[model samples]
Target: MKVRITIMPQAAVLDPAGVATAHALEHLGLHGVSSLRIGKLIELDIEGATEEELHQACRDLLSNPVMEDYCLEVIS
Candidate 1:
């Protein structure tokens, strides 16, 4: 099976990198983008792991629960 994990900062957390990227985009004349966020995408191919295991991996290793949120998807 193929899985995708997306990890991003929580809404209330300040994202310095995202803010910097947004500023850069404005400088390049790409206006009207009010907000931008930086996130991480992790793709994995596994043989027989259950969804629970994958979720545990995400919570423990892939993302910081204190500051980040995550979404897990089964691709195939």
Candidate 2:
């Protein structure tokens, strides 16, 4: 099976990557860009687990619950 996962920093955390990207955009005359956040998109293939089980896997190992949040999707 194929799975897609998205991981992002939590709202309360400061994102240095996002800050730098927004600064660069401003310097490049990209107005109205507002802001941005950097996140990770992970695709993986696994065997011997159900959809719900995969979610648990994400909770247990794929993400840091305190500093980040994650979303899991089954692609195949």
Candidate 3:
């Protein structure tokens, strides 16, 4: 099966890197954008797994539940 994980920082956390990139874009003449948030996408291909295993992957290793949120999509 193929799964895609989308991980993003919680609104309460400070995203320094995202802020820096937003500023860089402003320097490049890109304007009118008020905010920016950077996140990560992790795609995995696992053979024969149960639903519980998929959830465990994200909880145990793929993401940090403390500061980030994740959504799992099974592609195939």
Best-fitting candidate, scored by lDDT: 1
Shift of residue 4 alpha carbon in model 3, Å:
0.4
Of the candidates numbered 1 and 2, which has the greater TM-score value? Answer: 1
Q: Would you estimate the TM-scores of all the predictions?
A: 0.97, 0.87, 0.92
Q: Which stretches in model 3 have alpha-carbon errors above 4 Å?
A: none
Q: What are the per-residue Cα lDDT tens digits for candidate 2 across 1-76?
A: 8899999989998999999999999999997877699988889999888888978877888888888899988888
Cα error, candidate 3, residue 61 (Å): 1.1
With a 3 Å backbone cut-off (N, CA, C), the pairs that clash in candidate 1 are none
RMSD in angstroms between candidate 2 and the native structure over all alpha carbons:
1.3
* Candidate 1 Cα errors over 4 Å, as ranges: none
Better of 1 and 3 by lDDT: 1
Reference-based lDDT, each prediction: 0.96, 0.89, 0.90
Which candidate achieves the best TM-score against the true structure? 1
Model 2, position 4: C-alpha lDDT score: 97
Ranking by TM-score: 1, 3, 2
Candidate 3 lDDT for residue 45: 88
